[model samples]
Target: MTTRDALKIWIVEALSALGPSTVPRIAQHIWENHEAELRQSGDLFYTWQYAMRWAGQILQNEGKLSKAGPGRTWMLI
Candidate 1:
């Protein structure tokens, strides 16, 4: 899948591993664990952060993730 599409998977994996976490922490987790994949993602490497935010919102809308709460951390539902 494209890197933007991959964010949905990676975000869930990060939360499952790290528990509820801030956006930056989730991003760091993805970077640390998937740097090689990101490097190969072309334009997505530059836009992943923005795309991740959208992915999170989409997940929330789909009821797979909780709505943004205090501290703006994300959690799987």
Candidate 2:
């Protein structure tokens, strides 16, 4: 899968595991759990953070995640 696709899954996994969490915290979980995979993901190691945000938005649009308010954590729908 592409980096953004991978991030879509990871974001879901992060929220499933952590229950609503801030973007940084979700990123930390992905980094902690999938560092090896991410490092081998071509340019993703550098762009995953930005891609993660995009993935989260996509997820929200897909109804897999809730809309995030200002300074709010991401939640599953």
Judged by TM-score, which candidate is best?
Answer: 1
Return the lDDT, model 1, position 34: 92
Local distance difference test, each candidate: 0.90, 0.88
Global lDDT of model 2: 0.88
Which 10 residues in a row give candidate 2 its minimum summed lDDT? 64-73
TM-score for each of the candidates: 0.92, 0.90
lDDT by residue (35-71, candidate 2, tens digit) is: 9889888877789999899999999989899857557
Model 1 residue runs over 4 Å out of place are: none
lDDT of 2 at 9: 93
